[model samples]
Target chain A: MSHQSKRIILKSFPQGHPKESDFEINTIEIKEDEVKDGQVLVKLLYVSVDPYLRYRMKQVDNKAFQGYKLNEPLTSICLARVISSKHGSLKEGDNVTSWNLTWQEFSIVKGEELNKLPSNDLPLSYYLHSLGMTGFTAYFGLLSVGEPKEGETVLVSAAAGAVGMLVGQIAKLKGCKALGIAGGKEKVEFVKSLGFDDCLDYKTVDNMDEAIKKFCPNGIDVYFDNVGSETLDAVLLNINDGARLPLCGSISNYNDTKEAQGPRRTFNLISKNAKMEGFLVSKYGKDFGKAQQEITEWLKQGKIKEQIDERNGMEKIVPSFIDLFHGRNTGKVVVKIADE
Target chain B: MSHQSKRIILKSFPQGHPKESDFEINTIEIKEDEVKDGQVLVKLLYVSVDPYLRYRMKQVDNKAFQGYKLNEPLTSICLARVISSKHGSLKEGDNVTSWNLTWQEFSIVKGEELNKLPSNDLPLSYYLHSLGMTGFTAYFGLLSVGEPKEGETVLVSAAAGAVGMLVGQIAKLKGCKALGIAGGKEKVEFVKSLGFDDCLDYKTVDNMDEAIKKFCPNGIDVYFDNVGSETLDAVLLNINDGARLPLCGSISNYNDTKEAQGPRRTFNLISKNAKMEGFLVSKYGKDFGKAQQEITEWLKQGKIKEQIDERNGMEKIVPSFIDLFHGRNTGKVVVKIADE
Candidate 1:
């Protein structure tokens, strides 16, 4: 069988911040007979629009996030359904998620790279949020690395966003008092609705330290950081002894053309005997299987809830991604490419 | 042996930075017969002059280091010989060291607080620098926290000073290539003579980054940091992946009257996947015995060397401490108080 698939390709390397001109929509034809061994041809359903993808577009010599080459397909998380399989475990109807999947209508993924999702149990988009990379990050970053203890006050920045929301919820579930900082009153209320003990609107809070002190009467013990400029700076002054900081991302400084005034907390850490660790979810490859299983169980048990801000059409991938920077979406932002 | 002993007392607290005017060192008559059971009367020889004493001079609400109150004698590391022991283990003329010893000519110490030094083996001052708090700090900071691996590059700031010098030598013994940062050419040569792979004088180097790169070509694995400001900022950029930084002291920013720029390394930790642990030797009280025994063994084998800059007279304590901020001393500055 011969088929044609539409995909987004990297047209050019980003100069500083990404522009729509950097990506091009292209159509490519493929044959079933040409399918490689240990590969599954998948029809893309939902693609993850993440902040790290923007860094990948820049031509920087970073070993952590290797920049995408010009004219190559842009890579992101994709929840896809296998249409054809040459792999041992996956069948034609198997639904899977791949970190390397592109912003395309269809993709030929390596069998090992694709994780088979339970078809009927959860929302297909849930795999893109709580039970996927976003949730796994929240779990590992909060539980394992952050080591939030019961009765501890946990502060999460970008709380209404994908990873931050789940991190605060997970911390709350573990008996920790959780507080979230978001851009608007709506996001703050949204985070509060998700069971955070307190929420702060960073846009309105002129003196973040004063606001944080009011909410966190004791002091912050665990800080799950995503937004890293002023929020981090304020959090630094409020951290208690033996505070754990899991620096998952710095979305605030990601697109900054010049060096943003980074939060200087090194001096605070000394006085408080605090430990701050920055890590990527990819580093925990050994525990991913266990993390996914636990997260999936949590989702089924209603221990955690997820909300997806759905954007329609594959053509909206760039716009959805750009919206992420502007804090326009709530929960996990996913672009639904097709109807189930 | 019915005798009266002299003691020093703090008549008042310092307003900004501590001065001689803040202290009224009065000679108190101590009747040795009044010493209670489980207590030992000691004749102090050497009083440890540490930079942390300055931090304690400030009136703060911090539980860890509450500043010295008005009319209270400052307590610090002291080398003393027990003149009377009522609790049995200690005897008259037995040399010892105490974490609880007062900064005076004579101290009434609890028997539990004193550790009897092996007088037949090592110098009593060896117990001060190599077997006492300084040694324990250097040992624990370098080996336990830093985790120095063989063939890895270990960089230490404030190298010719007390703890830094010892840390460099220990890193060398662990088969690591050691680089040190000192304030002058003389101190730089001094650290180099102690078997460090390289030593950089921050005073001479135009660019800290260039100097660090020149010394640590392979990048730093373990950084025994004493000076934590611009020097630390430079080390942060050059640290290798999974690097360990034992935050022993931040002497550079200790006395900063102005809001000096804090060390910029949080992003480097994210990029390099490095970990900087701020620790105090007091926190590891459980393992102090094991560390002391190992350090004592190392000292007997001539594997580690110590340098002490002894200042004669008790009145010199305030001036000697002031000199520490100006980078005046070459080694561990000890105040030798004479008994008349």
Candidate 2:
């Protein structure tokens, strides 16, 4: 059987904020005969739209991140349902997820690379969110790196984000004061609804340092930084002694064309005896199963809450991704390609 | 007996770099009777002139550091010899060192506050440098915070000064490649002679980022940051994956009156999965005995080297301290107050 599918490719590297023109859709034909042994033909169910994609669109020489190549299919770690498998373990209609899933209706991934989704009551779309990378990022970045202790304050920027919202909720569960920094009243309300002790609408503030100080009365002990730049500078100024900053993302600077200039208050962290560490969710792969199990339990008990802004159709992926940088979408922005 | 002791007092707060005009000598009488029970009259031997003292001269609201009050005697943790004692444990001629020792000819100190010096072949002034706070700063900052693994490259700034010189030698002793950044040819030569694999005279370099890359071909694993600002900004750009930055001091921004502005390259540390931590040796007091034992053995084994820039008399204290900011002194700048 022949399947006609379309995938998005990098047409041009973005100049500053990405435009839709930077990408182009290409039609491809996949055949059943091409599903070699040890390969599973997967039909991508939902594609995750995130800020990290902006980094891949850059022209960097460093090997830490290999920027997307021109005229190459865009790839992400997303949710997929296996259509047919040549491997003995996975049968037809088995749902699985893996890395480097292309932005297309169908993709041929190594069966060994696929993680079979367990039978659960949670939404299958959550396989791309709370039960996967988004949840794992919040788990390790908050628990391992941030190391929030009881009676301490954990402040998170972009508090209504996929990871940030979960971070604040987890900090509260750990017996720490949860404070948030969000944009506008709607996001602030959403973040506060997640049980954050306080949420600051940064769009309405003048002095971020003073604004943060007001919210984090006892001073921030652990800062889960998603949006960097001035927000980081403000957190550095308001941090208490022996503070730990888990550097999950730098979304604010990802769109910047020129080198960023800001007040050098990181020196303040030196005097207060604080630390800032950057991390990637991929590196914590071995511990993923345990984290995912715990998150699954939390979801089942309704101890934790999650939100997803779902857009339908393949064409909505890039547009939804663009919405993320403009602060137009809330929660985990996901594009549903097709129903199972 | 009555003794006329001259002590330095804070005449006024400094505007930029501290000048001799900012301090004045005040003559006061010290009687043997004033050395009451549990108190010892001690003669000052050597006073360590360090940059941290500059922080004490400022007028500040916070209690992390209390500024020296106007017309009040300046005090530092320094070397002294017992002249008269009313304490059970100490007698005349006992050598000791303690905190809050006034920069004067004679000071009455509580016996409980002093750490009695052990008998050793090394110079008494070694207590001020390698065996005291200076050595502890380098030891803990590099080993505990920086956490350099063997065969890894460790870079340090202000490489010819008190702490920097020891840091590089310790990195070498731990089986790591040591690199240094010094301001002048003389300081660079001194750092290299102390077993640093390479040294960059930063004053001679046009671009520090490119200059650092040339020395650290394998990329920097650990950076013991003494000089912050441009050099720190440069190190951030050239960092490898999993780099550790031990923020010991921000000497570059100490004198800046207004808020500082710089290139925000710290975001790069995120993609590289790096961490920067600040530390104080005081907090590591429990582990001090073990660290001191290791450092002493390294010194005796000729596995490590130290340099001391000794200035004679109490009058030289303020001048030598001022010399530090100007890069005039090459080693651990110390002022000898009296003969043994």
Please provide, for model 2 over A248-277, each residue's C-alpha lDDT reduced to its tens digit, 9 standing for 90 to 100: 888888889898774378777667888988
The CAPRI quality class of candidate 2 comes to medium
Q: Which stretches of candidate 2 lie over 4 Å from their true place?
A: none
Model 1 has a DockQ score of 0.44
True-vs-predicted CA distance for residue B17, candidate 2, Å = 1.7
Best by lDDT: 2
Model 1 steric clash pairs = B10-B71
Best model number under DockQ: 2
- How far residue B175's Cα lies from its native spot in candidate 1, in Å, is 3.7
- Single out the weakest 10-residue window by summed lDDT for candidate 1 chain A: A258-267
